[model samples]
Target: MKILIVGNGARESALGVKLQEDKRISKIFFAKGNATTDNIGQNYFESDIVSLRNLAIQENIDLTIVGPEAPLVDGIVDDFRKHDLKIFGATARCAKLEGSKAYSKKFMQTYNIKTAKAQVFEAYHDAIAYVKNHDYPLVIKASGLAGGKGVVVCEDVLEANATIHKFMIDRIYGDAGIQLVIEDFLEGYEVSIIAFSNGQKLFPCIPAKDYKKAGKGETGANTGGMGSAAPSPEWTAENQIDFEKNILEPTIFGLQEKNLNFRGFIFFGLMVTKNGCYLLEYNMRLGDPETQVLMALLENNLVDTIESCLNGDDVELKFSDKKAVCLVICSGGYPQNYETGFEIKGTDKVEHSTLLFAGASREAKRIVTSGGRVLSLVATGDSFDEARDKVYADALPIHFDYAYYRDDIGKF
Candidate 1:
């Protein structure tokens, strides 16, 4: 089978590695892939969705998998299906769950899904007034996609005013902030559960925990993700049962009731609190650094699992008992201003962990930083300590100008 993966990041890189394990897969292709992916499959440097669909048809791709949210939300799957191309991803209408926070919040409310109370606003004055009346420590989020950097936790009216001004007035996130969702902050640790859905049932993968803060000790602004680990320490068997019953089943039922034929990944961002788990947000596809670690712990053939899910067959996803850890190496000043093009070294020397490139390109036969979050090193072991040790030991040698990484990953 020939497979085409759409995206150009570490998550796509990891997908390539996992898909390759399926011996039935004879060829792999990437759409506008990065330096790391170039080494794993045939890279097609194209960005247009129509052209990508044509490429899939041209290559006779048996299945095309989408790895990024932007394209999926933009209707890539819809476009492909229109041409009778087999693709894996949610339709644009269904993607609204991730593309628009306001829309998703409404969906949750309608389905009675457990989530924080929130109000959506379109006017600056209305938002300001709403914030003034709300309690402190509110979460202000852009209605549209902001690459995971749209939400901010405001501690006071002053901060809330500034964030609202930045998102609505200053247009920091452009049209993404044309509207915003102001919600009460849910206090708890976060767990990311990605499930394979066929519009009816769900096959949940191992829960993952990711550090979004750019600085150590959870300081600084949020980035794509700093680091991550699989089998989140916060996820208990009881939590699993509760999630499947209260969250997963309801989500599937809601999709079916809404007539949304979703056949792709459903990412649930949950905040486990003393009260219970509250849904934070929904993502149409897999999370970045989280994917790096989950791919390491997954023992099932990804292609088979996805196909089985799409067929609505009873498929049990298998995962390694070993714990996995991922440490992200980034260009300094990431999730904000930072320079790229710096030559990356020691990637070839890292032997203790697996290297998945996120933001890098080849120049003069050498790899150089091309984006903020560059790559991730993932390691798995019987224990989290062993995985963390392996990941850190291998992460030490990688170098780039102004490169930085969090030191507290997998500390739990």
Candidate 2:
């Protein structure tokens, strides 16, 4: 089958690599793909949905898989469906789960999902008053997508008021900050559970723990993702089943009840504490660095699984028992101001596993940093520690002028 993967990031690179390994796949194409996919597939022109759809029609591409949320939330799948093309992603309406936080919170509340109690506000004064009256240590979140740094965990009333001002009054995240969700801070260890849903049926993948903080020991601002590891030991089989019953199932059923047919990857961000699991947020597409590690441990044919979902069949998703970890190498001063175009080197000597380029490109024969998060080094092993060590070991070989990476991942 000829498949076209969208986006130009490490997640798309990893997907391209995995799909290339499937013997059934005859051709691969990337629209606005990064330097990595250029080595594996036919690189198409830049990703304009209209041009992409035209190319798919002209090339007779059998499948189109989206890698980012922007296009999906912008109605790419709906456009594809208009042309009678088979595409993998949620429709624009279903994408509200990730596109707008206020929509998702309202959906969760209406469905009685296990999430923290919160109040949504469109005005600064109302939100600030709520924060001042409520307890300290609340979470102030932008009501729309702000990459992953929109949510601020305020430690006290002073901090909460500051965050509220920044988000609502100052408009730090632009219009995305025009509305805010002031939620009670739930103390817990976080884990991400990603599932492939076919509107009616849901297939859960292995749970992963993502390091969102830009620095080590979780002492920095959140980025898209710093690193991640699969088969989080904390989320055992029992924990998985409980989460499935309480969180995932309810979410799927709730969407259906609301007459929303959802597809693509549904990401459930959970906070696991002594009081049990609390839903934190939802992502409509695959997580970034987390996808790098999870795909490394997946043994199933991704093409077949995604096609099965498109065909309205229950996908029997399968995964390897091995543990996998990925370490992200970011540009210096990431999640803040940083320079790009610095040439990177020494990836060929890396052993043990794969290297997926995230935000990088070929400036002549040399690869240069193209975005904040540059590349992901992934490795698989029998244990999480061994996998993490192997990932870091492989990452050591790659170098750039001002590369940065966290020292600890999956330690919790």
Candidate 3:
């Protein structure tokens, strides 16, 4: 079977690696994939990416799997369906779950989905007025897309005012901040729950925790993801019920009831506290660093799973018993201004770890950095400590100028 992968990131690279592991998959194609993906699959729809429907038909790809939100939110799935192409992901209308935070907050409220109390603002001054009356320590978020740097945690009114200006006044994130969600801050440890849905049934993967803070001990600004570990050792049976009642069930029901043509993956960003599991946000696609660990621990046929979900059959995801850990190596000043184009070295020396490249490009014979959040290193073993040790050990040789990686991942 021939497959088409979308976007340019380690998540797509990991998907390419998993798809290749299945003997049934004959070939793989990528549309604007990263340099790392260049080594894994063939690039398709290189230039005429605007007409994806025509491109998919020209290539005759059996399965088109999207790995990013931009194309998916751009309505690639809806367009593919217009031409009878089999693709996986949410449609443009349903992608509001991730594309527009204001829409998602309203949807959550309409469906009674347990989440933080928040106020939406369209005008800059209106948001400022609300923040002035409200207390500090609130979460300020861009209503539209801002990659992953749109959300900011304000500790005082001073910081909240500054964030308001950065998003709405300065247009730091462009139209993404034109509308914003000023939410009440919920105190808890953050965790991610990823699931596969076909607009009818839901299959949950083993819970994974992603480190969003750029530094160790959860300090510093939030990056896309620093590292992640699978099976959330503390995820209990009771917790599943709480999540189902408050998040998963309501989310699926809301999708079905609202007639949102959502397929593929669903990422639930949650805050777990004594009160209950509260929904923090949602990603219509898979999580980045989390995908690395999930793919490493998966022992079943990923292609079959995708096919089954597309066909709307109740399916259970199977994973390896061993634990997996993924640590990201990024440019020095990531989630901010950072340098690129530096030739990377020592990648060949890594042993017992799977290194997925992101924000990198190939120059003649050498791999060079092209964006921040460069490469992801994944390792799996019988225990978390074993996997964490292997990740750090394998990361030693893989070096590039101004490469920054957290010293502590999975140390909690």
Clashes of 2: 0
- TM-score for each model: 0.98, 0.97, 0.97
lDDT values, one for every candidate = 0.90, 0.86, 0.87
CA lDDT of 104 in candidate 1?
98
Which stretches of model 2 miss by more than 4 angstroms?
Answer: none
In candidate 3, position 178 carries an lDDT of: 91
Better of 1 and 2 by lDDT: 1
Model 1 per-residue lDDT at 294? 89
lDDT tens digits, residues 1-412, model 3? 7888887788988999888788877778777677777887786536344555666687778998888887777888888887789998988988878999999999999999999999899998888888896866899999998988899999988899999999988999999999999999998888888898876877888899899998888888988999999977667788789999989888888888998856698899988888888999988899998999999998878888888889988787789999999999999899899999999999999898988888988889999998888989999999999999999998998889999899888676
- What's the true lDDT of residue 343 in model 1? 95
Top TM-score prediction, candidate number: 1
Clashes (candidate 1) = 0
Q: Candidate 3: list runs displaced more than 4 Å.
A: 45-51
| lDDT, residue 315, model 3 | 81
lDDT of model 3, residue 412: 64
lDDT of 2 by residue, 334-412 (tens): 9988999989988898897688887898777888889999988888888888888888778778899899999897565
Q: TM-score of model 2 relative to the true fold?
A: 0.97
